[model samples]
Target: MTIQQRKSYLIQVGAFLSQFKSSGIEKRLDLACNDPFFDQMLEQIDMAVHYNGWFTRENVLFSLEEWDKALSEENLEKWLKSYNFQEESKTVGLVMAGNVPLVGFHDFISVLLSGHKVLVKLSSNDKKLLPILANYLVSINPEFSDKIEFTDGRMNNFDAIIATGSNNTARYFEYYFRNKPSIIRKNRNSVAILTGNETQEELKLLAEDIFRYFGLGCRNVSKLYVPQDYNFDSFFNAVLPWAHLMDHAKYANNYDYNKAVYLMSEFKLLDNGFLILKEDPGFGSPIATLFYERYTNKDALLETLQAERENLQCVVSQDLMESEVSYGATQHPKLWEYADNVDTLTFLQNL
Candidate 1:
């Protein structure tokens, strides 16, 4: 397919999504919490992992305009070649993350837009959503369906691979898959740095960056690197809108346990509604409670962060202007900002 064809395909996908905006994706998500199949899946996920809230269709709608802006033809071409998938016709295997609904779908989009076939290994936790989406897209343009597959089999025949897994699994991937070209995204923790320079409304927007998807995404702010003189009240006042998250029993339990840990272990505790502010040490995976930080001079702190960038995926604060973090915009990501630093399409072209 040509670039124009790709553009039309994206429009069809957007049209499908637009239908839900009126139908109200948020309501559907809330109902999914009570939906028998979804509830059953949630139980299995929550058994070993902490349960967090859902991302509604409205949540999906919330960021679409900017996301669409991020996907212009020139930008797609640049982002495509940035991952080196131009003029290629090879099978690309993607093992995606289920951290949030459709969290890493960009990798698959890149594969198709660049004229390649894809073998997707869906996370069991997020199986239903993607298949339904794939069916919708195929209905809009059936020929494209031949290029995509949801598979459970080993992808040994694929010319290249892109996998997102925990940090531990990254080492195994490197040892086994290193013989060929690959982009492997390991566990990463994203942080938010506040200068205490914003209004309540602005900070509330940033709270969406940390709390959306119940703080389960790699982009979620798990640690906040802030200035020493910052006012805690402004932060709390900003995040009050989301306090209702605590009403969900699954997330509340995490809040309760972590609150006790702060009290018993003598960790500095900062709690305003559902958001936790702690001088707690650090964590890669965000909990319902517990955000970390230590004071530092802004210049020195940025240099320190520069040294730590290899382990960081994307920072969500406005302070790091030279870096990707933008202020009052933690939850709103522009298009083509590849999460996990592994641009799958480019990895394939190099292969």
Candidate 2:
């Protein structure tokens, strides 16, 4: 199929997804598929949450909505205009991460849109949603059936590789795909820089950056760089909307365990019933906890962040850095905001 045809099919899929929202699903749009297929998708969304405790309904719908916005014809055309897809097609291997729902869908879309086939190795924790969406894509156009494949075992017979995993697993991928053109990603976390002048609305939005997906996504802010004399009262009050997250058993368990450990160690902590704020210099924090460090000056903080750029996915700030992601937008990256700042489409087209 031509690139326009492929993009048209995905636009149809996006139309179907836009009908569903976090509040409820509504059949408002005139979808191309039958009712049974749409019904099955709704069932799969619920089944995905059941299969993975971290995949809450709200989070899954948030992911779907983000894609629905991204798959517009204008967005697709604009994003792909710079790339040349006339080169010979090859099979691109994908090692997907399951930290959040549909975390690897961008790479899947990139490989196919670049006029190449895709062989996906889905993370076991996120095995349900993508295949169902892939089926929906195939239903939109039978030609797509030849473009997608899924494997549970070791992946092979591909031209190049795109892998996302922890630092340790990345090392294995590097050794295994040493001779191939590859983009092997390691663990990276996002952090927010607070200037102590942010309004309550901005602070509330920043809470969304921290608590969304239960702080599981690399884009989720796990740490904060605050002014030396920053107060916690405003920040804690702004996060009150998400206090209900403590109702989740897994989250509550993590909270209790982490709090207990901190208490035993006699560490200074600021707790507001649900989330814990600790003075830590680390980038990656445990679930139900947010690590923070005080910065005396902006220059030193910028230098430190620049030095740690490789270990960071993105920086969340107002005007601190040139590439700062807005307070609430870290999780809702656009189609071209490739993970690890590695352009998947360029890689695939070159290969």
Candidate 3:
């Protein structure tokens, strides 16, 4: 299919997703053979929660809505406008991350949109959702069936690669795909920089950055850099919306386990009955716990963050650092907001 045809088919898929939400599902499309697909996809969404405890209906719908917003005609056209795709197509191997729902979707979309065939290695934790969506896309345009392939074992027969994994797994990827052009992403965590003057509203938004996706996404704020002597009363209060998360059996178990470890280790922790905030300089924090460090000087903190840029996926703040994501917007990345700041479209075009 041509680029315009690909874009149009994606837009139709987005429209189908827009019809469903956490509140209810609706039949808003008049396409041929859509009823069973819609009903089954909704069933898959419900089944996804059982497959992975973190994949709640609310979180799944949030991911769907975000993609629905992203796959618009305008967004797709604008994002692809800068790339030239006249070169021969290649098979692009993708090793996806399953930390969050449909986490590797952008790369999937990127490979297909660049006119290359994609061979995807799905994360076991996120097995169901993307395949269902891929089925929808194939239904929209049968050509995609030829362009996309899912593999359960080792991935091969690709000209280039895009792999996301932990720091340890990335080493294996680098050695295995050493001869090929590749984008291998390692562990990276997001942080929030908080000044003493942040309003309650902004702090509440920041809470979303921390609690969304049960803090599994790379964009989820895992650490906080706050002014020395900063009071956390308002910060604790702002996170009330996510208090319901503590009710989840898995999250509650994590909270209990982490809190017990902290107490037994004699580490100081601030708790709000649901979430734990501990002072730590590390980038990655455990689930249900947020690490924070006190910063005495803003300039020094900026320098430190800049020096540790490789370990960071995003910085959530209000102009605290250059190009920092606004509070509460970490998860709502734009079409061009490439993961690890690596331009996937350009990578595919070059391949």
Across 1-351, the per-residue lDDT of candidate 1 in tens digits comes to 764586557655544333233234321342211244333333333342332235443444443433445555555555544342344578888888777766656777777777777889987656655565566556667877887888876666787778888888889888878886778888877777777787776687778777776777777777887777777788777777788788767678888887887779886677775766777556564477646676667778778777888778677665455776764455555445566555444555555
Model 2 alpha-carbon miss at residue 191, Å:
0.4
TM-score of every prediction relative to native: 0.82, 0.98, 0.98
Q: Which 10 consecutive residues of model 1 have the lowest summed lDDT?
A: 25-34
lDDT of each: 0.65, 0.90, 0.90
**lDDT string, candidate 2, 1-351, tens digits:** 777777888888788888767878888537776476678778877877788999988899888888889999989988988987763568899999999999999999888888889999999999988987898888878888998999999898999999999999999999999999999999999999999999999999999999999999999999999999999899998999999999999999999999999999999999998999999989999999999999998999999999999999989999877999998999888888989899888888778
Screening candidate 1 with a backbone cut-off below 3 angstroms (N, C-alpha, C), the clashing residue pairs are: 25-57, 83-346, 84-346, 318-327
The deviation in Å at residue 246 for candidate 1 is 0.8
- Candidate 3 per-residue lDDT, tens place, 48-115, comes to 88988899988999999899899999999888898887535699999999989999999998888889
How many angstroms is residue 253 displaced in model 2 relative to the true structure, after the best TM-score fit?
A: 0.4
Q: Per-residue error at 114 for model 2, in Å?
A: 0.3
- Candidate 3 accuracy as lDDT: 0.90
**What number of backbone clashes does candidate 2 have, counting pairs of residues 3 or more apart or in separate chains?**
0
